[model samples]
Target chain A: MSFSLKKDKQGVVVVGVDGQLIVGNRQELKQKVLDTLESGGRKFVIDFTKTGYIDSSGLGVLVSLSKKIREQGGDLRLCGLNEDLQTLFELTKLDTLFAIARTPEEALAAF
Target chain B: MTQPQPPQPPQPLHVRRRATGGDTELSLDVPSDLDYVGRAVELIADQLPGGPLSPRRIRFNFRTAFAEALANAIAYGNHRDPGRVVHVRVEVAHDAVRVHVTDEGNGFDPKGVPDPTLPERLEREDGRGLFVLKSLMDQVAFNEKGNSVCLTLRAG
Candidate 1:
């Protein structure tokens, strides 16, 4: 997975990930989250509109990142997940663990 | 103990094709590489009959199950060793699609896989692959050795 980060007018960081998020690129994704956290961007939104695939490994990274961010008194929201990803999150019951918004704007506004 | 045989040279990844009547069957011997999982998913998607499934169902079910099975084979079965091979066989019938994925690694007990649906297991990063496969596919079964997985999807 490759990501581009931009902060919104509210200073909430919006991370747009392109391509598949699988075991092959999960480390890079984790590092991106860590780096963003280190740079003091607390509120976050992960945009998954263009991300076509995700596996257990990818979900793992997201879960871990959510936990870490929460522990640090920050919040993360997910937005733009296509149908398949939404079903995946539901199947694994991860939907309960995340705050999902329909659009990036909603996610940004959530913070 | 039997003397350990010299490590055989790694098997080259290749696909074997067979055509019978109007049906097409393919078998792929891929090196235990995670990168090939996406390629495999794409190949399967390309071969699926177009009339029975919507594009969204195709992506949600077939690709998801296939990717999970391949990931398990490489990560748990082959331990991510490139020298190992994961054999995948796909048969596209008129009414159903069947895929068999076998790995070279020592098998584990499929029955013992954790229940990801339980609230306690929800936050864990791992253990969801099999659950997803079982949830989406019409049928998912493991061989006696637990090293091979068979997934089937029936046409609606």
Candidate 2:
């Protein structure tokens, strides 16, 4: 899986994955989150609209990043999760853990 | 293990698209046209001998297994060489399909992952890759050879 990141409106960072997020690339994704945090951005809105699918590892990466940001006084929200991935979030109760929105703007507004 | 393209053609995919097999193979080399693993699973499912299955089941399992194996190959397999080759083989028999996805990267110790179900892990978001694979597939096995890892999954 490949990802592109950009900061939007000073508070939101958009992360897009080119394809599925599986076991192998979770570390890279997690590092992206850490890098963003180290660079002074706290609020994030990860966009999964372009991502085809994601498994537990991908989910874990999101969770780990979100947790780390939260501990550092920042917050992360997820947007555009497809049906299958949305179900996974709900099943694992991650939906409750992270602030999830229907769109990037909504996620940004949430913070 | 080696796939030779025709002398004058962009037919590798077209030919493989038509060929059916009981072999379980996942190629990490992304074909420009078929980049996503979902498409690969569809291609593999089409080649299965059974007439067909419920669209929902097929779609579900395809998403699950494809998400698990293909992601690993893409993210973990070619980390060192940037441009590395990953091969996948599938064995479809009467009861189930056994798929083997091999990568060119060193495999990790599976035992290192924590159980997400542990009380302390209830709020943690990581450490669920293999767990989910084990839960979804009938079986999942990992083997290491030099810099390559062979991931096996069984689904009946």
Candidate 3:
């Protein structure tokens, strides 16, 4: 429902989501990331520490964004997924396609 | 002698509860708008807390699956037509909860929906809703029309 964006010392863009990501607000998140990608911001991290739920639409946007970023020679990482979210990613088999980190620092370091 | 009662018009949202068995039923008729999907799921899922289902199960599994069903009904089923209404009915019993989501649009065959998990289809943005809801719910069933779906979650 809410998002926070900051640049780390290593120039990685860290975006934090603070609520459920469903069809209602997925476009906003997608556009924000797309806009960032267009602005030459490459390395990215989405923090889900405060996020409680995400539907298929939310996952779709993440996939779309990740593909776009990768196609443009950039990379995106995700961190701070709760147990439920981890299971969701596994259930959808997206865990194999995404680079997941345990923390924002880990994501930033990986990039 | 019993008197005949007048027919009542449908409301946007209606809730009925049975006092004897602690059973609750909620029905919602909302325009096919994505904005109403999250709130509707919240309202329905709120009824399950402190009951037979655990908080984690209700929070993640039920909420996620229910939200997907509503989104599918509003967006894909009704094609986001404001004139068309999406009907949702939720019944919560002592041991389980069942939800029915029906849309105004023509139905499709669930069998035709391809696997999103296949290696060839990983990057597709859509088509994952059905898979996610089915994975989260204990049982998923579709009517012959396919425009209506029933999702059931049982307490352990």
Candidate 4:
């Protein structure tokens, strides 16, 4: 898996995940988001437009990151989940816990 | 013009295929490493025949569930020991695909696993692997020792 991180003009951190997010590379994602959180970037959006798949390890890291971000009084949103991912989130009942948007712009607007 | 590329080396996977009647059996032995999980899943996927299930359902359901089973075997069952190996046996039939994953560690009771969907446990980072495989696969069964699990997906 690969990840890209950038900030919008409004100072919202947008993280892009490319390829499958599974046990092999979940830590890299967590570390990147954690590094940004440490740097005082509050509002965040994780874009899954290019992500093809995610396993339990990937889901675990997202939950951990979301909790960490929320504990610091910040918020995180996810956008561009494909149908499979949507089903996964729904099956796990994680959709209720995360703020999901259709696009990065929509997610950024919410924060 | 681009230079001709060399033939790629074969993957470090042990595959033995045997045909019995209309069914095919494949066996693989991989090290207990998380890195091998994806490749193993892909190898198995390539061997699956097109049945009544749609391509999208086969891809998503099998990939997700198989990956989860391999990851669980490597990380939890074998404790990520490099010396340990995970054994995978697959039976591909006309109407279904079945896989068995066995690890080296002392197994735990499947029933003892707490429900991750519980409101109180929703935020927990671990313990979702079993839940995911069970949810996506048509049947998920654990051996009495719990060290081995069988995941089956039926053609619909």
Question: By lDDT, who's the top model here?
Answer: 4
TM-score of each: 0.89, 0.59, 0.91, 0.90
Candidate 2 or 3, higher lDDT? 3
Worst 10 residues of 3 chain A by lDDT: A1-10
Question: Can you give the lDDT of residue A31 in candidate 2?
Answer: 86
The digit string of per-residue lDDT tens for model 2 on A35-71 reads 9899998888888887766777678777778778999
Model 4: clashing residue pairs? Answer: none
How far out, in Å, is residue A10 in model 4? 1.5
Stronger candidate by DockQ (1 vs 2): 1
Candidates by DockQ, descending order: 3, 4, 1, 2
Error of 3 at B24 (Å): 1.2
Name the 10 consecutive residues with the lowest summed lDDT in model 1 chain B: B8-17
How far does residue B144 in candidate 2 sit from its true spot (Å)? Answer: 19
Measured as a fraction from 0 to 1, the native contacts recovered by model 4 come to 0.63
Interface RMSD, candidates in the order listed = 1.5, 4.3, 0.6, 0.9
TM-score of chain A, every prediction, order shown: 0.96, 0.91, 0.96, 0.97
Which lDDT tens digits does candidate 3 get at residues A63-100?
99999999989998999999999999998999998999
Q: Candidate 4: lDDT over CA atoms?
A: 0.88
**What digit string (tens of lDDT, one per residue) describes model 1 on residues B35-97?**
777777777677665755567667667777788899899989999896898899988777777
- Candidate 3 A-chain TM-score: 0.96
List the candidate 3 regions with Cα displacement exceeding 4 Å.
B1-20
Chain B vs. true chain B: TM-score for each candidate?
Answer: 0.84, 0.64, 0.85, 0.88
Let me know the TM-score candidate 1 reaches against the reference structure. 0.89
